[model samples]
Target: MGSIFGTDGIRGIYGDDKVNEDMAFRLGKAFVQFLKRSSDHPEVIVGRDTRISGERLQKEMARGIIVGGGRAFISPIITTPGLSYLVHANRADGGVMITASHNPPQYNGFKFFNSGGEKLSRSEETVLENLLSDTDPDRGLKIREEAVYLKEATESYVRFLLSTIPKDMDFRGIFIILDCANGATSSVASELFSRLNIVHGLINCAGDGENINRGCGALYPDSLKEYVLHLKAVAGFSFDGDGDRVVAVDERGDVIDGDQILIIASRLLKERGILKNNLVVSTIMSNMGLMDALRDMGLRHIECDVGDRNVYETMKAHGAVLGGEESGHIIFREHHVTGDGLLTSLQILFAMKYFNLPLSKMSKWMVPFPRVMLNVGVKKRPEINSVAAIRKVIEDAKKDLLNKGRVLVRYSGTEPVCRVMVEGKDRKRIDAWANKIADVIRLNLN
Candidate 1:
């Protein structure tokens, strides 16, 4: 058997070699067995996105859970963080979320959370994978024919979301736009907004399975930006397919990404004297502007690798309450165990109201340096240090930038490409340097 978990979880194209029903079944069984090692009668809360393959995967996993002598409760069509919340809220042994998270419709996967609503650590995943190797698929384990569905799971999650905001707060004059990415949030975003009496407009809330993330959501916020401008709303938010990520557009139609969001939120939290240790955690992908802004506010930040799990671990170690990725996975440790798009959106709104400032004005506190990024397709991902030519190019670029900027070159964890990022005071100079690095990578690796 090979490793099943990725930086997030097990993900692949549906019906593909790694993500078929059989694999899902085996994983389900393995997960339950691993849980049973500690608890005799384990229970799991299962949820999924709006992908067409989600239902089938959920069924197979649930079947395995039941066969392994564990109870499986299905929470249909919920966000990833919603599932995480349910696991901790209900004290289930674990939780499984079926989603590919901003991927195309053809792709689907699983993200597992512990009873604490936190993602499984690397060692935990290793233990589960080891169990998968010992399980016998043909052992004639009796599979349950029916699944127990949780009807009030969505409502419970919504109440939790509302509880995070103060009751006296209102959104009567605040008009905002939302692009649901035609995925899991579509089923709940409107209800949550209505319950809060928020004046909001929505787009891309209709999901046809295949239409989810098709030029919408966080990956493509241009349409959402246009809609925000048209409505002249105070702000706009676009959530990814699984509702784990978000990208925003300000009143001035300028995009505010996760880094900016982190800065803004950090400032607010610091004002309230709740920013733990006065530290914020961000990934390597975060912009230098965020660091500058944090410094200007007399706050500090630490850099982790490019995953929320990594960010969470670092945040925990350092007693930081806030952390996020540039791609919009913002984790507020005080309120959520995982990155939540809905929660992040609400927090941004609360910040806007508390500061009594438009997003455009708040966003101006951080002026991002000019940066150029190029994704070079590669036949294989080689260790950067081992490739002498690539190393030389990277070092040369760093030397040229000196103290004025930075250069980051890393292989994409999920794709066959090398990302070369150059940030500097001059856009043209950085673009040239970035292309120079990309050319070296393509020439040597591709």
Candidate 2:
């Protein structure tokens, strides 16, 4: 009964009260109703990741769309970005992607996109939320007819990806590992890499509908590090369940986070004169090292809030072409409206090709300061500034760190947890401070 939409989307364990088939149907109908204001007969593109609940939910949503006097086209298995592309390419009214991104397999959700392939803005989401609440579940019987499936969606997406990279650019000698996380990118990645003639191996590519993000992918890039070393590959890329984010592993089995990826891509784009405004936008969660590296390269840097949507909005305001989060959501504004993992991977590879350097070398520009992050489960989410004890501890830690480091205390938008991040020149000091803050939060909130 709480607000269904989170920072990303509506997410919870499948079959739960909120994420059940009934909610899916209602959401579909609500979305169509919202779209009808612009178009009399609205059309929607629907896609899902490889979760067991996806097909059932898709059918329910299709039924709702039909009953709502709209047309539905289903791209049964596709990445979030792929669905975004198809929405714009086909000129649909809107689109819906059924996924939970990097959340565990049991979690599933809906991500809405407008006609321009951008995630629904906060104001648009609010409209949809109002519609969702007003939808009547018993307004119509379920329609047995399912949404029309787009069989060519995957192929078209691959071709579009190829168009992003130069046709003459050679990828023959680059051996890389791809961890699909057994999600939406499993078969799509195989086909794309094969077409490009890139020598690559895949891990966690076989999804039984239950293994997506199960001990693999961006959430666990270290899981792919050994495979990179064993294959003697130049680098490895691990994508989240829905393929909107990615984390890279270098040849030395070191994890190259989004900060490092942004640094590498920004430098290449700047040299090519494609970096508009010579600016980069990252989230507050980004390492200080990334900001320092940008300064050293004489590139303007800005910090936004924690979400990728916030980063993109900030990028738009500043006319910056590159923006991302430390959690691996990198948006190359020149290529697409939202984050695309495959496109980002290609950008990284393009950077490698442009510099004639290996990822291990390119990733060395930023030396992250010693940092510690602790997540504390909470029974309630109270304002951090409102809690006197918690506020006092955070203020005390800030004073102690002084000019050397900083402390950030915030709640996870998608989960019921408080995250405490402390960074400083001294690791031990930061670690102790982080623990102190986390313990205080737990005492007050739990």
Candidate 3:
């Protein structure tokens, strides 16, 4: 009954309250009930990442949908964005993706998308929550039908992604590397690059379910960086568990985060005269340098809250085609409604080819200010401003930066942690300051 959905969706350790089979089943019935308000026998697309629990959750949800008089089309082992695309492409009423994204293997959840392939707005989520509170998992336990399985789901997504790139662009002789995070993309990334004639190596592409995001992926780009340098490849990319985020590595082995990727892609779009309004949308979590870089290029920058959904909504409101978070949730609105890690990589590749430059050269436009982030585990989340000790430390850290740096304190929407970020010219100072803020949060919240 209580709102279980976090910033993204209902996420927690699998088998825990709110993420178990019963919740997934009830949520599915609720989703069906909500969709039936507009259409009878609403069709829903269901997909999941490589988590071991994904299959179980998908089956339970499908069972609920069947009993609720809804049609469920289940895709085999697909990424979150892939599922979103299918929802839009298939013209389904809506979709659900079983994933916890970058969270560890034990964590799993669902991301729901509307028919337009956008994440559900807060109001829509509320409708589902209310419906969930009313629905009983066992009340309509008779399954009338089995969910339909789409065997070509991954193939459809791959084909659509390939189509987004230019037809004539040559990728021959481009040696690249990919770290699939042993997650959703593991099954499709290699096939994608191979079709494009890209000479590539894949690491962490084998998922045993438990190995997804175990130590590789966008969350740990160092492994990809090392592989990129060791192979002397032109570039590399690391994707998160759900394949909605990416962290790139260049030939020089320098990690290119979402901010740099945004700068690079924005410049390319501007050069191609396709950048609408000359505007880029980024979250407040973006680096100060990214803002400066955008200004230097005479592009407009709008900062939103810390979520890709927030960035996308702001982008849509302003007619902006480019937006993302610094953590690698870049949304190329012109191509898709949601962020796709594989799509982003291709866009970056397109940028490189369009400019006739290597990944390192294409990414050198921005010099990120030194930023340090510390995450403190918390038992509960109160508004940061309402906590005097935490608020005072955050304000003092900002003041100490002398208008040159900034401090941001926020709780992780997906996890039980408080994130303290401090950025400035002085790395050591910001690092120490971030730790101080994190310590205060720990003392007060923990």
The lDDT of each candidate is 0.90, 0.91, 0.91
| Model 3 misplacement above 4 A | none
Of 1 and 2, the candidate ahead on lDDT is 2
Worst 10 residues of 3 by lDDT: 136-145
- Give one digit per residue, the lDDT tens place, for model 2 in 4-117: 788887888998876879988899899999999899988999999999998888878777887888899999699999999999999999999999899999999999988888
Local accuracy of candidate 3 as per-residue lDDT tens digits, 320-402? 99999899999989899988999999999988888899988877799899988888999988888999998888888888998
RMSD of 3: 1.2
Q: On a 0 to 1 TM-score scale, where does candidate 1 land against the true structure?
A: 0.97
- How do all models score by TM-score? 0.97, 0.98, 0.98
Q: Which stretches of candidate 2 lie over 4 Å from their true place?
A: 139-146
Positional deviation of 279 in candidate 1, in angstroms? Answer: 0.9
